[model samples]
Structure formats: C-alpha cells, structure tokens
Target chain A: EAGVTQSPTHLIKTRGQQVTLRCSPISGHTSVYWYQQALGLGLQFLLWYDEGEERNRGNFPPRFSGRQFPNYSSELNVNALELEDSALYLCASSIRDRGPEQYFGPGTRLTVT
Target chain B: AQSVTQLDSHVSVSEGTPVLLRCNYSSSYSPSLFWYVQHPNKGLQLLLKYTSAATLVKGINGFEAEFKKSETSFHLTKPSAHMSDAAEYFCVVTGERTGRRALTFGSGTRLQVQP
Candidate 1:
C-alpha cells in the first residue's frame, strides 16, 4: 500500500505571506497529525485530526492552523508567516483504533524569507 | 505531562560494531514508545515501538528496543552497525491527557558509522 503523501515538496514565501501545505493519509487510516521539524528544535507536534475533527494541538501560535477533509486528507495553513516559520512540515497518519504507530510522509519544506 | 529525552546528540561507531541509542521518558501513565530513523533528505521511518505488550520489541532492519518501566527508559540497539544505519534517530512518547493523545519527541541523536 502507498504511504502518506505530501504536496509541493518545497514551498517558498516571504514574511507576512500565507502558506498552505497539504497531506494525504494512507488508505484505511483515520487519524492525521502535523508536526514541525525546525532546525535545532526537533519534531514538534502541530495539530491532530481524527475522523474529520480537530482532536488536539501543540504549543504553536494561532497563526498555525489546519483542517481535515472528509477524505481524511489535511491542510496546514500558516498565516502571516515569519522567517522562523521556515521548517520541514511532516504529516503522519495511522488507524485511530490501533495505537500510536503512525506512518509519515516525505514532508513539505517551507522556507520563509 | 509527558516528555522524552535522547541522551546523546551524536554517536560514532565503526562498521560491524554494536549500536546503542539511549532514550528516557517521563509519563504519568503507561506510555507508548517509538523509535524513528530519518535519513538525509528523507522521511521518518519507524524502527520500533513498545505498547505494554512486550518489554523487548524488535523492529525492521535488525533494530530493537527495550522498555524498562522502572527505569523510565526505552533504548534502541542494533547488533551490528551498517553504513546505511547512519542517520538521525528520534525517541517518541505518546500519552493521553484530557481525552486527547499527543506525542512528545526527543531532540534526536545522530548516528555516524565509519567504514
């Protein structure tokens, strides 16, 4: 089976611009998670969506928001982006009932200038 | 609250030598642990996980981890290090709070294998 897939593998934007990164979960998976892997910061959880509902979030700002589609895909939107927002954004998914072993995607690298 | 810590920022070993990546976790409840490996410019791959079913869990690529509840540790190990094993390894802990499950990741340990 195909693994999780992300779009626009790389994104470039300037300060104050808005960016949207997309992810498609693996088949039969119901939970999608977003994480920010910034240099020196490790992987920080951003958002968690389950069954099309926002289940949980991390310690990020309001500018970091995302939504899940009916198809179990997800989109992370960063508003008024700052240079520090540049990082590798990863998306992971797993069967909600099964445990926390998530399958990850290649991630979308966002570079804000 | 739950947290994970990777003891080593980097470790260098020779080929055919044993590999050890240390990880410690703190959780109020029984936690689910995982080891993920990330290659250069690649996505994170699951090396192993512990979910209370087995104290010692074996994963892909000859990697394994032992979950010691008393010590609050989940350390990854490999019998022999290969050149392809050079990558960044992350230890993660998942726990539930207020009915929501969240994961806490460690800073990661970079492994370097010498020929």
Candidate 2:
C-alpha cells in the first residue's frame, strides 16, 4: 500500500516569509500529525489533525498551525518564518483508534535563509 | 507527563551481530510504547508497538521490542544485524490513560551497521 507522502522534499524561503507543507496519509487512515526536526535535534510534535478537526497541537507557537481536510490530507502553515524555523518537517498518519505507531513521510526540509 | 529516554545516542554493530537499542519511558499511567526506524531521507517506519497487548511485540525488518513494566523500559532488539538495518531509531510512548493521541518521542538512537 502507498505510505504517507509529503510534498516539496526541500523548501527554501527568506526570513519573515511564510511556508506551507502538505501531507497525504496512507489509504484508509484518518489521523495526521506534524513534527519538526531542527538541525541536530530530535523530532518535536507540532500538530495533530483528525476527521477534519484540529485535534491537538504541540508546544509550537501560533505561527505554526495546520488543518486536516475531509479527505484526510493535511497542510501545515508557518508564518513569519525565522532562521530558527529551518528544519525537517515531517507528516505522519494512522488510524485514530489504533495505537500511536504513526507512519511518517519522507518529510519536507525547510530552509529559512 | 510522558517522556522517553534513549540510553544511547548511537550504536555500531557489525553485520550478523546482535543489535540492542535501549529505551526508557516515564508515565503516570499505563502508556503505549513503540519503536520506529527512519532511514536516510525517509519517513519513520513502525517497527512494533505495545498497547496493553502482548509484552513482546514483533515488527517488520526482523525487529522486535519487549515492554518491561518493572523497568519502565521498552528496548528494541534483533537477533542479528544487517547492513540494511542501519538507520535512526526512536522510542515513543503515548498516554493511554490520559487519552492522548500524540506520541512522545525519544531523542533517538542512530544504529550503524558495519559490513
């Protein structure tokens, strides 16, 4: 089966610009999650979307927000990007009722220069 | 609060050798544990999970992990390592009791397989 898929494997944007990352979950999956992996750092949870609702979010600022569509795809938006915002953004999806062994995507490498 | 700690930042093992990656988690209630492997430029692949089921969970790529309640640990292990097994491994725990869907991840351990 097709696994989780992310768009724009690499993205480059100037500081203060905004960027949007997309993710398509595996077939029949209902939950989508966003995470950020900063340079030399571990993955930090960003947002969680399920069944067209923004279910939960991580410790990120309001500048980082996302939404899930009825089709189960999701988009993460980051406004006023800073150099510190540069990192690998990953998207994962899984069944809402299943345990949280989320299948992640290849991730989009965001570079804020 | 829920947190995961990977005991080692990195581990190197020769092909055909046994592989062990240690992970410890702290949760006030019964937590769901998982092990995920991420290859270079690839997404995280689910190795296995323990969610109030069998203590020993086996996953793809000949990988498995056992959840030990006493130790508050969920460590990944393989009988033998393969060159293709080289990747970054993460231990995750979810708040099953708290009814949280988000999974808390560890710092991750990089497994280096030497042929």
Candidate 3:
C-alpha cells in the first residue's frame, strides 16, 4: 500500500508567477485536502476535495485554488504567487467523511522569490 | 473562532525519560482533537485523535494524550523518549461546522531527545 505521494518535491518561482503542486493519495482513499505551511504561519487549510467535488476551503485568496481528478489525485494552483506564498504545501487524504484522521504526503516546498 | 495552542515551543528530555507536550483548545462544541508529528522536509503524520469516545487516546509509537474538558487541554505524553521521537509535534482541534470537520492546528512544539 503506497502512502500519499507528491510531485516536484520543490519549486522556485518569482513573484506574480503561477505554480501547480500535485498529490496522489493512498489507493483506497477518496478525500484529498490541501494545506499551506508557510514559515511562521503554521499550517492553514487550503482546500478540501471529495469524490471530485470541491467540498470546503480555508481563508486563502481566490488565486489559491485546487481540484481533484477522477482517480482521487489532486492539484493545487497558486497564481500571482508572492513572497509570502512561499511555504511547504502539504496534501492529505482519507476515507470520505471518516472524521479527522488523514494520511499525509511529503509536501511540495515552494519558494517564491 | 476555534483555535489550538501548544503550551511549549520546545522540550528537551533524555533517553528513557518521560516526555510531555502540552496542548490547549477552545471550541464551542464538544471538540475533536488530534496530535500530529512532522520531521524536517516531511508531511505531518497522525499521532492520535480523540473523537469524544475515550478521553485517553493512544497513538502509534507509544504516544498518548488525554483530553481534559474542564481545563480545555489535550496533552501528549510518552512513558519513555527515544532518539527517533525527536520532531515537531502539533496539537490540533477539529471544528464541527456545517457538517465539515476542519482542523485547526497550533504552532508546533519541537521535541528533542538527548542521548
């Protein structure tokens, strides 16, 4: 059983650029969540996708959006990235509506210069 | 506005010594609590969770936490510390709003296990 996996491991972009981060969940998981772990800001929930539907989102900007694929994989897109947008973005997944226990993937570290 | 707070920013303990990581939460409803661990460059791992069933919750790697409602705290503890246990630990609380369980995380506590 492979755990959640993320892509690009790291990314470097300048201000006003757009960055996309990807995540593939465990085989049987149906819910995927995105979280932004900015420096000194702790972890903030970005979005939640369940069964390909945009379920919930956090207090981030509209430029920060994401979606889920048919196979339960997810992609997070941060547009007009600013220096403050630099952070380790994490993706997690779990069985649908199964409460708060989520399996996480090694996050994608994005550095906006 | 629900929030989670880790009482200690860092803790140091020797091998085989007991370890404690304090957490406090504020919520209007009967809160759902969790503990997560993260090593450098890695994602957060679910240490344990309390879903109102049992006050004392045990997680992997011999870690446990007790939810005290009166004090509004859910503190993580371990009987013995191991070098492998050194990492950043986060205290989290889940908000039950509109049938969604959104987690509120605290500023992590860095645990150091001395050999």
Scored against the true structure, residue B37 in model 3 reaches a CA lDDT of 98
Judging by lDDT, tell me the better candidate of 1 and 3.
1
Candidate 3, superposed: residue stretches over 4 Å from native? none
Top candidate when judged by DockQ against the true structure: 1
Query: In TM-score terms, which candidate is top?
Result: 1
Clashing pairs in 1: none
Candidate 2 residue lDDT tens string, B16-72: 999999999999777888898889877788888899889999998899898999999
**iRMSD per prediction, in order:** 1.3, 1.4, 1.3
RMSD values for the candidates in order, in angstroms, are 1.0, 1.2, 1.2
Interface RMSD against the true structure, candidate 2: 1.4
Kindly report which residue stretches of model 2 are placed more than 4 angstroms away from their true locations once superposed.
B97-99
Give lDDT tens digits, candidate 1, residues B1-115.
8899999999999999999999999998879999999999888999898988989999999999999988999999999999999999999998744445667899999999999
Chain B only, TM-score of each candidate: 0.96, 0.96, 0.96
Q: Chain B, model 2, TM-score against the native?
A: 0.96
Please list the residue runs of candidate 1 whose C-alpha ends up more than 4 Å from where it truly belongs after superposition.
Answer: B96-98
Error of 2 at B39 (Å): 1.0
Sort order, DockQ high to low: 1, 2, 3
lDDT per residue for candidate 1 within A19-95, as digits (tens), equals 99999999999999999999978899999999999999899999999999999999999999999999999999999
- Predicted candidate 2 versus true structure: per-residue lDDT over A1-113, tens digit per residue: 99999999999999999999999999999999999998676899888888988878788899998888889999999999999999999998989776666888999999999
Task: Please give the range of 10 consecutive residues that has the lowest summed lDDT in model 2 chain B.
Answer: B94-103
Cα-lDDT of candidate 1:
0.93
Error of 2 at A6 (Å): 1.0
Residue by residue across A1-113, what tens digits does model 3's lDDT show?
99999998999999999999999999989999899999889999889999999888899989999889999999999999999999999999988666767889999999999
